[model samples]
Target: MARILSIVFNPSVDISCDAESVQHTMKVRTHNLKQYPGGGGTNVARVVAELGGHAELLYLSGGAVGSMFEKLLAAGSLAGHRFPIADETRISLAVREEQTRREYRFVPEGPVVTTAELQPALDFIADYGADYIVASGSLPRNAPADTYARIAAIASRTGARYILDTSRQALKSAVEKGGIFLLKPNVGELESIEGTKLDEEGATRAALAIVRRGAAEHVVVTFGREGALLAGSGGVLRVPARHVETVSAVGAGDSFVGAMTWSLAEGHSIEEAFRFGVAAGAAAAMTPGSELCRRADVFALYEAGSRTIN
Candidate 1:
């Protein structure tokens, strides 16, 4: 049983390319195309590996695309297994323009995996050994929101805690199970959940509200470059990120979640884990590619310049 298991319902095979410019409603020339296995959970696994922690990526697998995903995971020396599905996996591309310093991306809906495919996958995860489970991203068509909720329940039955991140009914159901220790929801997603406009204050308020509701014991409201606010037993701890040059915005949030989970698994306190996440997010922001961060970079940023939002 790996200590960390990341699950993604909708996985992607990302092929990113750099383009000259992204003018409104116009075709543009692009270069520097590169492809790799993608999706939130896979990204988490990569970051965990970079941080010297153990993580296994469990995702829907089948067809050639699924085979490609398996190959990619194997290349990283990370353990990966497949779930049989009918549809071939989907693909996406990020086109970065050098002239205007802009990027345009082509994204497609991932495979619509069926319930038949999902059950065995869940069964496989039930046998997995992990201290913490990180479930992130959107549900493919036919996956009920509580899909993660059931998995979270499985983790609890198996003696492992889980961090659930997703939007809508899934988010609601997972919180209902009441075993989730930490949850990270963006402002928009939280807004949709609470049925109100969730701005900065509203986001924090929502975090406290969820805590009061007992869906989650601790909550972190991520505000992109604005930093993240933590809502726990001791109230909110605002972790303001230090300024850093950004090459690409891909996987910044995922890096933060992975790092925070890794730190806590490594026996750091909540405050220490918060700092670890801030540095990890900054490290990913400074990296040029997707879901890439070296442990050295995270530690270096931590020592040189990370600060709490006091």
Candidate 2:
């Protein structure tokens, strides 16, 4: 198995519950509450483990809430190396209103992280190199915009394929610095980077431009229900989205990245890996609240879709 390492700058304890109706000035009764360790890279690692792949996790945590988060993670099959921070890890909530079939999410900006607290993670990445280094999620308040850029540099020096999934200044800075092996950006995020609304043709052109410039070797733009497009040196390949009843859309993107990475690490072709990613994403949507893609569902979907594509 190819060694994989996933890093999360801002992690969270994700709490989800369902309520009949959400109304102001009323005590809403909730049930089916679930809690999970969450963050972009954290979710990626979880999906990898779910698919019988091992990905070492590196993340920052602190305070009482951090302890609670650790317990939740320990309950899973992943073991991680934690870098202590001075601030408490944040808690995010998602409430599903059964009446409207809508999910409401409340997320905090997260605690400020000092350079001192962030350096250890950088150092760890430098010393503990792997086949692939996945840096996902947002930078905590007060972290440098060039943080992911610096990580890209480290991945280059360590001879690891760097995969990045982020948005805003972080994404811009990293792409500007180049050397990314794969860049996964949703349509909205791609639009944010391009600074304009892009139709499908415009989106393909933009992704190819990035690849031609050597900013990234492969660019995958996900369009949710419309499916995803991959642009690389070999040209663009489109994977249609798997239509399924969505229990929760949360974690679907992470599931895509995770399963794709695992497939790549297992020596599958880029096209095969892309198909696995789409399958995992659909499987994740079929699940409830913070839970990622299931292994059996992933393969079933992948095989079924493979036949359709064939």
Candidate 3:
């Protein structure tokens, strides 16, 4: 098994429920309330474990909410290492309006992490090197913008493939600093980095440019329903989106990153892994609320999609 470590600077307890309708100045009754451990890296780790792969999860935890977060996480299969912090962890909520079938999500910015609280994670990465190091999600307030870039450097020093999925300055800093093994960026994020609007052809060109410039060994740009495009040394490969009933969009991106990393670690080729990733992402969409892709759904989708891609 390939050793994988997933780092999350901001973690949360995700609560989701269904309400008949959301109206102002009214107490709306909710049903089927569900809670799960959530965050970019945490979700990725959960998805990896769901696919029968093991990934070590490292996350910041503190305060009363953090204690509850720990309990929720302990219910899952992932082996998590909680780094203590001073501030309370955040709680995110999603309420689905039954009338419109739309989801309303309320997300907090998360706790402000100090330098001392952040250093332990870097130190841990240096000591517990793995085959792949995945850092996903947003940088909490007070953390440096180049945090992921610093992680990429540490991964380089330890000879581990670094996979980053983020947005804004963190994304720009890492891309500019280079040394990333794989970068998963949505179309908007790629556009922000390149500082321009991109059509399909332009997106492909931009991805290829990043590869050629040594910014990232591989770049995958996700285009929601249209699908995703991969650019690397071999060239660009495109996979169309799988048609599925989207119950919730949560965790779809994390599923892609987790499944792709697992497939690559399992000795599959980059092309094969990319296909698996698309399948996992679609599978996650098929699920309800914050629940990720199911193992059966992933394999079935992958096998079905593989035929068309082949």
Per-model TM-score on C-alpha atoms: 0.93, 0.98, 0.98
Q: What is candidate 1's TM-score against the reference?
A: 0.93
How many residue pairs clash (N, CA or C atoms closer than 3 angstroms) in each of the candidate models, in the order given?
3, 0, 0
lDDT of each structure? 0.79, 0.92, 0.92
lDDT, candidate 2, residue 84? 93
Question: Can you write out model 2's per-residue Cα lDDT over 162-251, one digit (the tens) per residue?
Answer: 989999999998989999999999988899899999999999999999999999999999998788999999999998889889898789
| Alpha-carbon runs more than 4 Å astray in model 2 | none
The pairs that clash in candidate 3 are none
CA error at residue 17 for candidate 1, angstroms = 1.0
User: lDDT, candidate 1, residue 31?
Assistant: 72
User: Which candidate achieves the best lDDT against the true structure?
Assistant: 3
Per-residue CA lDDT of model 1 for 135-233, tens digit only, reads 887777778767988987897799887887777888877776767888988777777778888778888888998898777878888777887888987
Candidate 1: which stretches are off by over 4 Å? 23-27, 289-291, 305-310
Better candidate number, 1 or 3, judged by lDDT:
3
lDDT, ranked from best to worst? 3, 2, 1
Query: 88-178 in candidate 3: lDDT tens per residue?
Result: 8999999999999999999999999999999998899989969999999998889899999999999999999999999999999999999
Which residue runs of candidate 3 sit more than 4 Å off their true CA positions? none
